[model samples]
Target: MYPTHSLLEKIKLYSIILWPILVTQISYHAMNVIDTMMSGRAGTTDLAGVAVGSSLWAPILTGFNGILMAVTPIIGHLLGKGEKQEISRSVLQALYLSVVLAVVVYVAGVLFLPSILSLMQLEAEVAYIAKHYLIGLSIGLVPLFASNVLRFFFDAQGYTRITMVILLITLPISAFLNYLLIFGSFGFPRLGGIGAGYATGLTYWIIFGLSLLMTKRIPSIRAYRLFSHWIRPSLSAWKAQLALGLPMGLSIFFEASIFSFVTLLVSRMFTTDIIAAHQAALNFSSLLFMIPLSMSMALTIVVAYEMGAGRVKDAKQYSWMGIALSMLIITIASVFLYFLREPVAYLYTDHPDVVALAMSFFLFAIFYQLSDAAQATLQGVLRGYKDATVPFVIALISYWGIGIPSGYWLATQTNLGPFGFWIGIIIGLTSAAIGFWIRLYYINRRFSSLRS
Candidate 1:
């Protein structure tokens, strides 16, 4: 039994731990929502264009983020084990690696944007709009990469508040800029959807700059040179990180791709109203999903630190605590959203048909949050253990093998329509949650045995 004072202390500590993460998550999702709202004003075609373009971009971009995720645990472990110099070396190397990877991905995305959009079977006008947005957005990849590296570094050092500060500054600036640019306010040109993309790109640079400045202020971070003799990438280290990162990257790709793919798949079966409704519901779900997502990030840091310090019991306990907290928070959020689904759907658009469709999908979303929170937490636990491949395999099998096929069958082969597509998401997420939890249990057992 815990003492009341001790329990209060733990609550305070956890709140401090979660606050920055929560802020960052909220800011990021808010930016996305603002972008969507701005784009919707341009017309449904514009909205659809951004949606499809975003789907194509997320898997590729987030795959890179997955690589950065690999770095966090490594840095967290090193920080915990008091390998300050090694942490510095790894971070510098990771920064360089991230820049290189971002350049490659950006160039590839720009060059292929037209081709990819063309292949997506979008309306011609929508394709044109999406391509323009993608072109402007692609240029900011390096800055985005840099920002992620800084975020991971701070998170690893248990200084999550820096990200919150940077995001607080960036989010409003980005939204205001987006408003000005998208609507021709304040003497800014109305580039419409393209303007939103430009605003986002500029915001990425701002975040990168702010993160760099804050990073320089940290005594632990400032002790090492940004580019020193130890900054070169070790082939062995790269391989080790890749070995751990690739699976995680693929897992993220699989999961993000499923939603993205479903968006496209639904478009094939339904009209733009249905597609718009789906997007609105998805956007809301994604935003709310950030709560669990932040919890996952915090869990990774805490669990990895404990594990690295050889406190196996503490690590296990921390992971479980994080999961419980995430579930409770998400459950409440889901309930709130469920009760307010129609009003929430109206926030995206005024179209009655779209609102109705969105409200219908929200019912499915309510189910998704529980499973999604569970899967995300377990994935974080696996990250702490540096075990990625099994989860990746599980995501692929569940998402592709079960989720997509069922969605295709239900939406096309059956009569469930757009709701059927959401059912597919429910199935995929639930399966992933169960699979990941089972894998975590076995891994935890093995880890405990070894420790004993």
Candidate 2:
């Protein structure tokens, strides 16, 4: 067990982990911003294509990545228990699993993406860009998946700075490549928005290479010898990870896919300008979302470590602290979003109509920030406790069972038009926040009683 610490000490420790994580999360997500902004500059059709492609891609990526996230808590628990010997084996198995998942996602995308896009009934060029953008992205899935497991391994050990440094190194390279390929700058062929996908895919390979180097060369990490010994694929390990990870992944998928589904629904009903505007606002909102998301990720690590050591009280403290902090930061962020909505809208497109619609969407985005932060951070706290199944159920019911249907009805049936979908999102997130709060309360009581 670890020694007890004052709140100030805990804050310091948390900050050490959180700030790097926040930077990395923001920088990594900035690639999406780069994609949106650069492609927006190309043309509205390009912007809309990327947006729809992203709508199709983000949920799949998040779901699989979320599955890979089980590695973080698994390593966190092992560290808390001082089981250093098992770290390399667990991570290696996760890598093997990543390869398999990558192949599966790639195959599925190749087979089904065209059909999916066709169903959306997008314009011809828009359809081409969207299809090729995903195909380009699919090329990097293997590295992307593998590096994510490596990232989780590092994060679980409280080495977020390593990933942060790597991302810092990669972000500019990605942006430069995006510029070259998207606009045909410096003689690179003009791929427009489709080039963004290729740039992102190439960046993933670079990240994987750097991540492996860090694993092999870093003195402290080298002690784990993650590569010195290769553990053959083991069914039991796969089962263990899947058991914990599948629910967590599905929970994330449920939440993320709701937005994607909304985009798809919007694509069906809205004009290109409207779709561009919606994508622009949604993209900005997603960037802001990384703030709470980073907090939630940190909570998962710290809370898992505390819970693993049987310090339920400390776990509770960290959980509440992170949740409270997330709410506070998002509140401040919402204020900025309100004041700067117009400039922010202009960043995505110069088109007056798109900018106007995007600004309006920002209000709804602002309205949901608190509930979103609360629910997201609470999910992190529960994951730390190794409690995922119930949250998955809650997310599904809230997002699909309630959120989507409500949004669709409002958007289609009411005079609210596009705004109706935003309201549905508010309802869904608020419901999730309320449901997760009740679940955490019960979970806390159970763990506290056990501790007593």
Candidate 3:
């Protein structure tokens, strides 16, 4: 199907693509994990603030990031069709979209955020810290979105290694800044939970600015003429992107909203220690999650290229390859998490109560990680096919219709408490994973080629 390449050859191709993605995910996610750890050190209240704030921020971040995803698949499809020149317009349009979304998100976040937090009924001090944290974070949304736009442009051409290098290089600096600011290290004013927020915004803006400069200075990037001309976004492009991306945005929103809700409610229903534990356990789970997420993105690019080139069977091969690879890797990672949860939890915080609580909750992550891996891979495959709408609805139903409500019910009504919330997570992810795979199956059967 793919010019008779050996299984080893396929693995080689995938490996070339997958390694950078894996490394990048680690670095990218490390920023948040670092924040949680440092905030934990600052105090339990600070840690709870960061946790609750991140929950709200995750949905905003993930949803906007998903919407801006129009650029990557577009670039991949163009590359496959040998239409490299048109990529500049797509880049320009995506930038426009990114900036506009950034402004809207910032405004909406600032205006309605207080009311939302008020409803959560968090303690006065924690709420104050979270409110300020969102403010600092809101300022950086523009550059953050822009940086991701640049990432999509380069990553489409298999130049993912640069972004990976950038993030890895940024990771340590991010940690250093968090330490300096969170605790007033080196004579700096201690900002507590809000310090991580300020550090994050500044670091992200710096990354975005430097990345843009690199695109101009780097010969490889200059070849695309991405900055050669300014082009206004056309109606058709807007329609096309929104049609493809809105569902993606909503889908991501629904899934993240569940966790966000749980984090907020837990803060109200339990002590700051439980919130800290939730934050720490979540950070650990997210660290491992990057592996499957990276694999999924890489597969999306490969599958899009193959499908666009009319290599339908090759696309399918890569699809299965992606799924199998993720499952195997996650299975091993789960085993490691199973045995090492205590040490890992200890790594986040010295507080015995928080450590124990986080470790207990981590067992649920081990069980659900498999489902999460499958769902992530499927989401990517569907994106490659540009068939996001159906999966979007499925995710909404799975996560919201079933996941959040049930988790809330369990948390409120049952003795399982925090563990009950986790049980809901497992059910949601498992259902979404199965639903996504089934959607892909229908698409494959209905259309001979992936690009329908």
Arrange candidates, best TM-score first: 2, 3, 1
Q: Report the error of model 3 at residue 320, Å.
A: 0.5
Scored by TM-score, the top model is 2
> With candidate 3 superimposed using the best TM-score fit, by how many Å does residue 345's alpha carbon deviate from the native?
1.2
The deviation in Å at residue 130 for candidate 1 is: 1.2
Rank order by lDDT, top first? 2, 3, 1
* Count: clashes, candidate 3: 0
Clash pairs, model 3 backbone = none
What is the C-alpha lDDT profile of model 3 across 1-452, one tens digit per residue?
A: 12325667777888887898789889878888888888888888888898888998998898888898767777888888888788888888888888888999988986899899999999998998898877777768889999998988888877888788788778888888888888999999899889999889888987797778879877888887777777876778777788888898888788777778778878888988898898888878988999988998888888777766767777788888889999999999999999999999988789998899999989998988999999999998888887888999999899988887788889889898987888888899899999999998987776675355
Query: Model 3 segments beyond 4 Å from truth?
Result: 1-4, 449-452
Better of 2 and 3 by TM-score: 2
* Alpha carbon RMSD to native, model 1: 2.5
Off by over 4 Å in 2: 1-4
Looking at candidate 1, the ten consecutive residues that score lowest on lDDT are 1-10
